[model samples]
Target: MRAVVYDGPFKVSVKQVQQPKIQHPNDVIVKVTSTAICGSDLHMYEGRTAATPGIVFGHENMGVIQEVGAGVSKLKVGDRVVMPFNVGCGHCQNCEEQKSAFCTEVNPGFAGGAYGYVAMGPYMGGQAQFLRVPFADFNALKLPPGREHESDFVLLADIFPTGWHGVSLSGFQPGESIVVFGGGPVGLMAAYSAVLRGASEVYVVDRIKERLDKAKSIGAIPINFDDGDAVEQIIRRRKGKEVDRAVDAVGYQAVEKGGNTEKPNAVLESLVRVVRPTGGVGIPGLYVPSDPGAPDEAAKKGHLMFPFGKFFEKGLTMGTGQCNVKKYNRYLRDMIISGRAKPSFVVSHEIKLDEAPVAYEKFDKRVEGYTKVVIHPND
Candidate 1:
């Protein structure tokens, strides 16, 4: 089998590797059809994380069940399914409470586990011909058989639910306004979710013209930070009214306006400035405890100097963490089935498995029109 293997900083390759097998009685083997490269993967690709060489590089995945283990009863061979990026053990306390993202049993010392991610778990990613799915009964979401929603269904594995989770984290109410920082896939989904939930206003901030245009196509007001301070741009566009809520979709790798320098807390500070007093902020972006590529010593240790004083002064609330994907994927899946959502709109390219290395480089560079890249491993 061939899988996308992490080679080193700014490097990845689709190479032949050992195929995964059923290791537990409850495990199942999946023939992967579709997977995607997430922005979080860039952290490892850029040597910011402790990702070692040869680790399989995928988390968003969907496919058909090829084989089922002895204990797998609800699911069987030929079941079309999508597994959430989070790898939960199903029986852990967190899983019992529907917070599968933080399952204590899968990653041991870590609070959560994700397929093919650094420090998440030992689970190999699905960006390959096949994948080993543990706790199949609880982890895989059954989809209606067929290829009708292939593009949309695959998103249920990660970004779609994650974007919805970001809005939920903000305690958003219908008709409330929101400003989502970053216009990448997750950020666009956040804005789309806001629109579906009846937000009175939705603003998306980004420097890229392509991403901003996509945000506009989805009925969101696009704020180009490169033109000026994102907060000021949003406020001016809103006629001096701060938004009711804000979301940070651009985590630690955030860059300054009109420049390429990384400002780790740039989005955090902007969220504080743009959100109304007593309002809330949701952060669905990826932020690690340590960043080897950070620009400063404090940031290298995962500490940022955002305006905590302003946050406290304004009586703001914040919600931050990995999305508990199982908590929202089922409902979001149904949304796709009913045509209420089409997150595939953000997918700009669909390439074969062998094209993954090039996709990684282009996507990492934020090249125009490269908003999202989905890989079809078996195509």
Candidate 2:
């Protein structure tokens, strides 16, 4: 078996590794068909997160079940499934509250667990030949017959559901305006989700040309912050009308528009400044409680100096957390199946597992047209 193993900051390698086996009576071992290098993975790749060396690095995954444990009656061998990043015990109080992202049991003493992530749990990632999925029946989402849209279906594992969660967190009402910061995969999907949900208009702010273009292709108004203050640009473009809701899709590593300075809280500050009075904001971007790679001492301890006063002054409400992916995936999957959505439009590259290391560098550098990268282990 081969897996993308994290070596250190800005390093990864596809190396032969042990094949996974079912560990729990309710577990299933999946032959991974597709996996992705999530933007969040960059935090670990850059040594920002506590991702230790020798760990497999992928989380977004969909696969065919190769073996199933006896207790997993809802799924069986050969069933095509996609899994949310977070691992949850179906009956936990948090899972019962539809907050599987914070499920208590999988990562003891921690709020949640995600496959292959630094602070999540001990579960290896799916960027390998096989993965052991715990609580299989409850965690794995079965795809429709014939695997109609494998590329599109692959997104249901993370970004699609996570993007939809960002929109929902923003209190996005149909016909309301939304401005999403960052045009990366999740941000692009956030704009796409906003469009599908009937946002009167979606504004996506980013400095990258390719990302901005992709956002435009999805019927979103692309606002290039490189041209000027993104908040002012959006407001000016809307003829002085502020957005009703905003989403911070760029977190921790956010840079200033058209510059190299690390202003991690840039998007959050802009969102507070641009969202209309009494409007809402959502942050689905990854923010760590402790970032050893922070550019400053204060930030290293997770103390960002964003404009909380502005958010307070505007009477705005905010929602921030990891996306409870399972809570929204089922409904979003139906949208994909119904032809009402195609989150796959954001995928710009499909590479083999062996090419993951190179793709990681390009994506981390925001290479032009490297909007998203999907890894096909079988390729």
Candidate 3:
């Protein structure tokens, strides 16, 4: 078996590894068919998060069940399934509350568990020839018949619903205005979700023309932050005022004029500057308070220099953290199946398992026209 192994900052290698086997009575062994690299995986590749070296580097995955343990009854050896990024024990209190991302019974030290992500649980990543899924009966979403193209649903593991979660947190009403910072996959999906939710206007701010073009293709107003102040651009369009809802999809280490800054404050700063005074803000971007390789002492505290006074003065509300995938995955799946949504629009690259090394390099560098990359382990 082969898997994408994390070597170091801006490094990943496709190497032969021992195939995973069923280790628990409740487990199922899946022969991974399709897996996708996520922005979160970039955090591990860059060594910004706490990803362990040698672990596989994928989480957005779908596959065919090759074997099942004695206790795994609902799923069989030939079932097709989509594995959510977060692994949860169905009996946990948080799982019962639909907060599967913070399952109390699995990986208790953290909010939840995920495959091949930093600061997540001990689960091995899914970007391999095979993977062992614990609590398989509860964790895998059985795909409907005739759904051969599971690549689109692969986004269900994280980014698809995560983008929707960002929009949901904003509490944006129909005919309202919204702005999303960052034009990466998540930001693009967030803009798409806003359009589905009846937002009259959606503005996406980013320096990249390629991503901005994608935003425009999805009917979002593209604001080139590189041309001028993004806030001023939005204000000028909104008649000298900010929009109703603002979202920050760019987390730590945001792009700056000369280079990237290790500051979570940049996203918040943009939100405060572009959101209407009484409106809300949605922050789905990643933020770690402590990092072993932080660039500065202030960054070590995970605190960004935010304008809290302005946030308070304007009475703006905020929602942040990892999205609980279980809460909306089933519904989002239905949307895809029913032709109401299409997540594959953001997939910019798809390659075989062996091509991960090249894909990682280009994606980590934000190479032109590379937004999301999907890997087929069996390709």
Q: Find the candidate with the highest TM-score and give its number.
A: 1
How high is each candidate's TM-score?
A: 0.99, 0.98, 0.96
- Which model, 2 or 3, shows the larger TM-score? 2
Model 1, poorest ten-residue lDDT window?
251-260
* Better structure of 1 and 3 per TM-score: 1
Give the per-residue lDDT digits (tens) of candidate 1, residues 1-379: 9999999999999899999988988999999999999999998999989999999989999999999999999998999999999999889888999899999999989999989998988899999999999999999999999899899999999999889889988889999999999899999999999999999999999989999999999999999988888898888888999999998888999899775799998898888999999999999998888888999999999999989999999999999998998999999999999988988999999999999998999998888588889899988
- lDDT of model 2 at position 31: 90
lDDT of each: 0.92, 0.90, 0.85
lDDT score, candidate 1, position 222:
93
Model 3 spans with C-alpha error above 4 angstroms: 258-262, 292-295
The 10-residue segment with the lowest total lDDT in model 3: 255-264
Per-candidate count of clashing residue pairs (backbone under 3 Å) = 0, 0, 1
- Sort all candidates by TM-score, best to worst: 1, 2, 3
lDDT of 1 at 136: 92
Query: Cα lDDT of model 2 overall?
Result: 0.90
Model 3 local distance difference test score: 0.85
